[model samples]
Target chain A: MTTRTPFDIPAHASSDDPRVTLDEALGTFEPIPPYPPRTEREAEFYTLRDGEMFVNMGPQHPSTHGVLRIVLKIDGENVVDLDPVLGYLHRGVEKLCENADYHQAICYTDPLEYISSLFCEWSPVIAFEKLLDVQVPRRAEYIRVLSGELNRIASHALFMGWFALDLGGLTPILWSFIERDEIVEMLAALTGQRMLFNYFRIGGVNGDLNHEFMSRLGTWMSKATHQIDSNNALLNENEIFVRRARGLGVIDTATALNMCMTGPNLRATGVPFDVRRAHPYSIYPELDFDIPSRTEGDCLARYLLRMDEIKQSLRIIDQCLHEMPDGPVMAKMPRLIRPRPGRAYAAVEGPRGQYSTYAISDGTDQPYRMRIHDPSFVHLQAVGLLTPGNLIADTMAIMASLDPVMGGVDK
Target chain B: MDRALRRRLEARFGEELTGPVRQRHDETEIRIAPGDLPEVMLALHDEPDLRFRLLSDLAGVDTGTTMQTVYHLWSDSSADWLRVIADGLSRDDPRVPSVTFLWKGAEWMEREAYDMFGITFEGNRDLRRIYMPPDYTSFPLRKDFFLPDDASRSPGGGVRPMEQTHGPTNAETAAHVRQASSS
Candidate 1:
């Protein structure tokens, strides 16, 4: 009997063995190398000081959000440096979009940020609409904002739960998930699916606000702010939650801007830059809401900022409901979609940050190139910058505060 | 479109620009040579009137003949998104300067562009592949890149499922599975 190793072939086996070439091929797919460091970053990360050691948080660790592996270089409990090893959940969505037609490409983008899939669909749809020079009806624009804000609220609810759960609290996740479930259910009625809703299309949204969705939103809105306040009351003053998150992973404004952070993370640093406000797309210019910000730039500040933004989102939703113009939801369009050969960049301020898509058309049905700029990808880089001096325990807390969904990060 | 901002850009980079500045919708685009990226980017970042501090996005494009790196910038100076297209890079070895000096955030975006299109950022210290595994050789987003199943990728292979550039063969996978179940 041959001693078995992972994808190993017996050393004494003849070269003519059928498995020889296959085994050699399998060897290259090894996730970790049995060999030494190959690149400069790998060498730097692998090398350790006398008392320091490397700890892998996960591609499987519960706190990583999704299949994200963070390599932490630690001396005692203090993280000396960290490297984020990504591509674990990479679906090659951009490459896939290049092969698919414009309308079909929106469906491909739906799962990039699974928590806020509507925003994922929104950017690409807007870009395609720009390429086609299609003017969507006013009612459709309002519905997009209405449904998008609902998704944002749901996402923030989940973020609150996950953030609290990461800091050794259990109750908040349940509360947040319950809130998130209600929103998801409401969204399912509006769209067809619970998650990864391919609701946004090139011309407009898939459907108008139906009775089921309207009823759910009306019920949820009456007590939404109160429920959020009650759930936040559980952690907003709790000593452990505050102590763990407060003043931990502090990033200042200049450093935050230099890191290209947007959304809540940048807002927590007092930038006041929301893509919806700064670069107005859709009917956001018609809506009135403040871009809530905090000066501290700590994990606590980030958490608190999202809680505040939930109110702002609710305000936007309320305004969207009251001011929704009566018209057709989708515009008249041809059967086949082929945008003119040009480039379009469209971004929306999602719950996470700026979810943008840059689409280049070559007068063909399929996009010549489609690049998705996810906020998670930009914010994940800042983790390496933020975690160097912090303790190991605070690593997850810091990451949770940033709220990086690995789907978006890896896409 | 902001014509003044377009005019200002033309006046500033008229000589260095490869093509005329084009403004459409809410975007103003400029085509520049690869050599002028760093100089132009520096001016856009530092100039008091045109302080485009925010690096909104960086994208890579393959025009079938030439490779291009597109950068989108947002600033209070201009209402429109300023796009700088570093055009006409050699397809054989597409190399452009990195913008990490101005926005440290451009590092990963540049790395991704390099990973997908093989466009090397000359000044990026950490120019490793971001998405593809370290052993991957071919740039996936290149116009010529073909899947293993595609006839053009491996001619006369009869669509061999496991004969991809990075994946193992069926026999090897089965062997691994058998070994795993026993363990």
Candidate 2:
């Protein structure tokens, strides 16, 4: 209920203390030289004549998305060397979770990846349930898949808007939100929250979908198809959009996997490694859907993959609607949840990427420590690897395709 | 963990297996001495059978006794997930060899571990704080760190103090509100 942000602990009591410098604050962690190859690709395409011109692209800029600041060394328009400076939006979500108990901690994960907050909300709940060995009923499992896929469609719609916004197309984003808002509204009806729906409980959901929600969802599906069509019409085949994003910011399979890029970003690089299919959590294994991927691994492929994924999410939603069982949504929970002294890891294919949570319980009501393995934190690593050779203009396009939510990246 | 990979790791690090490779809630954890962390991780990455090329996550835990570093690894080929735990370091100097050389994805994660738990990842190229500012003196995630208000954070407690620390006490507020309504 409070408006205060976490990670608000001041680094310095006052700025006057010259002795308390940023370098002096480092306990033992040190930054070493010979950083990853500044520009590893062909020099003729994106190299600069000189590497002296360094520019900070973010910490506030819109194109970088969120508060990410990339220190770009330029030669004319060519980027020579780059270093992504993060932590601007750090809210200490991981540190805050340990102090709260099992049920209380689920809400804290909402803002961590707010694009499809239902997905982010599910990771910790899944982890806690796994640790405690709680089994959700069959009906609740179907509800989870129902909410998750709807959230994915909503998230991808927003991505379509923002990605086009990055590429200088305004109308597409406005149109994308028309469909996204309806899906989000449908979710809000189920969860009682408009934006950060902390709806997923340890064993089940906060409540079941009402009759009105199902009726509205049935109507919204037809409208959502038109919204997806508008985005493709605006940006997919357009001459300028394709020319700009076709070959820009291409990453190979080895580098993408090595960087631990998950979700659509990893899938675009031609690796069919979806956590839903590969790991098979919740009701995902029961449902049938394809993990659409592209071999090109460029900005266009990344953008197109998300668009295709929206359709796949719709397919999942269609199945959930047709075969959703009628039963209790809330599972029976113990008065005090005390999972044994062990650790549990659970992941959901979040809108941003593979959002996973590792919860360690020391046989107490409270978790000893909880770590969020956010995909954006790992996916952001590709920024430094992807940016050095491309033009400064293409930077926004590359960053847009990555689709990082600051909550997860800085959590 | 797959049966074959567990045997290979146990065979490779004969006595250094701190304990039996224990299964914690379906996931297997391979505990290694702090000294043998880098070696075990290298073999996990390079050895043909277990290619845990993807470093999913790296985190630090304050176990009341010592600071423990946990590494979660994933194999793309087999979809096998493994947890490699490096234990045995006091709070004063939690030094463990950095695995930045093995997985490039570990750079920021290790930096974050160092940032939160003050665990020193020796030889990590960029060990700057990933979440907190570089100048932050306290390790916020450590078990001992607590805000003054954190003591009173328990739910459904009786006779709770008012949140306004610098204002009138609750009794004073009640009196003031009564006076205003009467006036």
Candidate 3:
């Protein structure tokens, strides 16, 4: 048998290059004999040989948390090849956005990234604001920060809960949901919905936070802090949790940077890149909080970083509640938003990572085009790199650690 | 690496730069010709101060007459965001060069653009249906694509609500209650 090396293509190649043909380039690397035809006597033509095992993980598995099917080729206990098949829960959200009005489209954004619904809403809302040249009021900015932080805490809690669930612990999922429910209730009071809160408008928020909501939030924040501390002591101190997660999905700083992984996943690799601190949108410049980072780029490090981020989010929320100025929740925007013929992009440090929106307004009330930059979408790319050369069991651990809400992925 | 670098880019890529490279209302937008997209993107990615190595998003916009593609690139090292706009192509022939080779993150974004706007990328592989079904007809995002209207549907073709009787007998009411309870 003759083996060939992987083909190396230049970064920039001219259109006239003879090696542009995909078949010719790939053919040079390997030559495998064609498969024999299936016979009537044979039950199946594609049966696995003695050592090879082919397993279909799920379009309905618990670890994925959504309809994501992964076809794994295993050699003994180690995974040799993993091909991710998508489109199981495809709802054609982008196509639906095209038909929906700019304001009405906010309803779909929340569902796009169900885990971090607020950030999804923020992306489109902020983009619309930029396209229309509308400045949000100070009170609205404070309210936006408060809501965004609450959503962040909620998302991280779900991640922590789900990560523990993947590692075979049932208690943390229940414990995490308690904090998540409180935050969701606080958000529901302002937005009038629980899961997909379409509360952010182009110019500012949809409405103001009431006194009762603020008081309840203050109480929930203190209770959540105590619960998180106690929960951490219970879970973080467990020897099994530590052993499975400590260095299972170790990604170095260079690979993390190259892969474009963001949010807590990237921060866990020791690169203190928080878009809130870096870009500083929506009164984030004034808010004081630490950008959490960990030297170990592993599953445990990401878990620790997310926990720290939740604390930091609490600090930001407390500050916003204290310093929130009394004013109109929304700015004076035109009845019909007909922006000049130009394109603009707005990004925020979402619960997942850097959620961005690129909108093109061509002198019309409706956006000419809209593109959402989901952090989970980019972070999911690192999964293939991390999972290879690891055992099948460890693969689930790494995927859970990444915390990719597949709605964001398949959107 | 600062103001000087912007000036150098402006001078070297003259009309290719399109408009003045400046922030408008706290957001930065840089326009370039379709052909100049790869060069401008490379320069933005390579420049020390403007190390926008990550192509955060790539989306297409239709202006009724033409289609425009926007690229949002961000640098993790610098925490800087740069919005690059390429001139629109005709709706009939929406073709653009792919940037997957430079940044692998553009793989899904470009596929999304293709799926929604019917804009074809020259070098992208595995460009089959993304969010929509493989057999779905017509681009749903286009302004002209209309949703199915019940008013326009032929008589008896549209879904109609089940007719209800004003008064119900004891047996009929009991049957309804039983059905509801079972459901």
- Clashes by residue pair, model 2: A112-A408
Error of 3 at A254 (Å): 3.1
**Best-performing candidate as measured by lDDT:** 1
Which is better, 1 or 3, measured by TM-score? Answer: 1
Instruction: Residues A1-411, candidate 3: write the lDDT tens digits.
Output: 234223555657665764543443342311111434223212131345578766777778878779987766678898766656567777766656644668777787779987678888887888788767788899999998999899999999988899999999999999899888988888888888888888888888888887767777978877878888987886789999998899888998877766667788889998898888877788999989999999899999999899999899989988998898998999887666677766567788987788887766656565556667777777776776788788998888999998888998887
Question: Over 4 Å off in model 3, which ranges?
Answer: A1-50, B1-6, B15-23, B33-36, B63-68, B76-80, B88-93, B122-126, B134-146, B149-183
The sequence of per-residue lDDT tens digits that candidate 1 reaches over residues A58-107 is 88899999998888889999999988888999888998898777888989
lDDT over C-alpha atoms for residue A278 of model 3: 72
Query: Residue A90, candidate 1: how far off, in angstroms?
Result: 0.9
lDDT of 3 at B109: 69
Give the least accurate 10-residue stretch of model 2 chain A, judged by summed lDDT: A37-46
Residue pairs in collision within model 1: A58-A69
**Alpha-carbon lDDT, every model:** 0.86, 0.77, 0.73
Ranking by DockQ: 1, 2, 3
User: Relative to the unseen true structure, what is the C-alpha lDDT of residue B137 in candidate 1, on a scale of 0 to 100?
Assistant: 73
Of 2 and 3, the candidate ahead on DockQ is: 2
Which lDDT tens digits does candidate 2 get at residues A1-411? 233322343665465654333433334322222233322231222344544565777677887668887777788898776777678888888767877888888898898877878887888898899888888987898998988888888888888888888989888888888888888888888888878998888888888788768877988887767767866888777898889888888998888877778889988999987888877788887888998989999999999999999889889988988888888887799868988777788777877777788888878787878898888788777777887878887778888888877777888
Fnat for each predicted structure, in order: 0.57, 0.46, 0.37
Can you give the DockQ of every candidate in the order shown? Answer: 0.27, 0.21, 0.16
Error of 2 at A151 (Å): 0.8
